[model samples]
Target: MKPGALTPQDAMARAVAFFEHLEPAHLAALDLIYAPDARFKDPFNEVQGLRAIGAVFEHMFATLDAPHFVVTGRVLQGSTCFLTWDFCFQMRRFKRGQQQVVRGASQLVFDEAGRIALHRDYWDAAEELYEKLPLLGGLMRWLKRRARS
Candidate 1:
């Protein structure tokens, strides 16, 4: 790690902490960590530009209850980093306050400034999200079983 520069580990750590403590107030602060034209993608949506990225997080807080990310592991290689995380939260519209955990990972690409250029998340939406819901959960589980050989 250099003296004043943001190393890959430092960036990952900062991101982990940021997500763990993220609130609606810190949406603007994303500009500090992500490039202006950054690309962010997950299983459900793909967005480019920091404002669009911020809107994603904003929607998360608006739609979920106390949503947070717990980073379990990190691997850094060159300008790309992979972070395994546990997304823990409760559904605001369904399942009430019961805790739900979605295990997933993210691929982060950093530029010369150490700000994220691309943030891609990989997870099984059917298993991690839909299968945890009430009505959808049952159908998802059934579909999973049907799809299995």
Candidate 2:
């Protein structure tokens, strides 16, 4: 309990606020909520360190239009938290104006210092993303239809 030290509760609140209010400018301040060597993994990328993690977010901003997260639910226990959210964005390449939503969840583990040590995202790339693409959408639908019971 030192001056300016964050408790786990504070860190969780900060993490949620950081994500919900994230903007390009906030990219420079990730260290406030993440450990220097925090690991972030998703269906498409796995990266460690603040710089690398920031790059992943940067890439998202670069490739997608109006990308944002809407937190739906959360569960917290000890140093871990699970957050379910909807990732909404417009595909810059294909569906330019239409907003796409991908339901996902993130498991965050915080360090003793209250900074996120690990962030792993769980989501189905095929059903959530690929099924919305151009040529791939049709193929994915067909494959799903064939697999259904």
Candidate 3:
């Protein structure tokens, strides 16, 4: 079914399905949710088009052991839908023996066609990511604890 034909709830459902189907080895589902010229931005990446967006996901999957997107909530207004997502993944830094789980949220905007036109993520990079990395994680946690005390 075409994205535009689906209701807001259906559209959100489709997006969820896309995420669920996304695997570390393949990325064909992105073509279903993001417009061909969609603009996606985050702490590490700022780019347009599905190819670039797919690359971001590819990189994450490559670096992380198991990466996935969990949609927590969604709001629709007119032709736009704001989606709250929790991106979860496990990454190993510098040949570490184990992987670490990293999570973040994103606010997504969809076009009338139900394709993601813009995706702006909202999360603390220092706390969620930088603080999870090997060396930086130690420094960040130290500073955080020091500030709190």
Candidate 4:
């Protein structure tokens, strides 16, 4: 290991900090944490490259109000780190006054330069998101009940 090279633990910490303190203005600093051609995937989005990834966040900010992440746990092995977090926000349209929480986990793979090369988030949209909506909530709950029986 080089003396001045960034360590995996360091990179993990940076990623966590970036998320916890993230704001609309911080979007420009994503390059500091992610590789140029990094890939990002979640339930609704699958995108490669920093620009596309940033676009996802931009849309998030535009649609949600006061969105933020709270990391509850983390596990680091080699250059890969897994983080469990709660995404909190208020919907701009439905349930505009109520705060929503979506618990999820993300697997991040860091490059040699200590930048995230890949980020994949895992979460159930039906349970976390769809079930909270006005019209969709009823259908989502019904489906869950039927599946459980």
Cα distance off (Å), candidate 1, residue 18: 1.5
lDDT of 3 at 89: 59
Candidate achieving higher TM-score, 1 or 4:
4
Show model 1 residue runs off by greater than 4 Å: 1-5
* Global local distance difference test of model 4: 0.94
Every model's Cα RMSD, please? 1.9, 1.2, 3.0, 1.0
Error of 4 at 103 (Å): 0.1
Worst 10 residues of 3 by lDDT: 95-104
Q: Write the per-residue lDDT of candidate 3 for residues 51-147, one digit (tens) a residue.
A: 8999988887777766777777777676566666677655655635554444555556666667778887777789877886778889999999999
Ranking by TM-score: 4, 2, 1, 3
**Which run of 10 residues does model 1 get worst, by summed lDDT?**
1-10
- What is the alpha-carbon lDDT for the whole of candidate 3? 0.73
Residue-level lDDT of model 1, residues 1-149, one tens digit each, is 44565887778778778877888998878888898999999997899999899989988888989899888998999879999999998888878989999999999998777889999999999888888877888999999999995
Residue-level lDDT for 146 in candidate 2:
95
Of 1 and 2, the candidate ahead on TM-score is: 2
Q: What is the C-alpha lDDT of each candidate?
A: 0.88, 0.90, 0.73, 0.94
Q: Taking the tens digit of each residue's C-alpha lDDT, what string does model 2 give over 1-102?
A: 556667767877888888888889999988988899999999989999999999999998999999899888888898898999999999888868998999
Candidate maximizing lDDT: 4
Clash count of each predicted structure = 0, 0, 0, 0
Better of 2 and 3 by TM-score: 2
Q: Rank candidates by lDDT, best first.
A: 4, 2, 1, 3
Model 1 local distance difference test score: 0.88
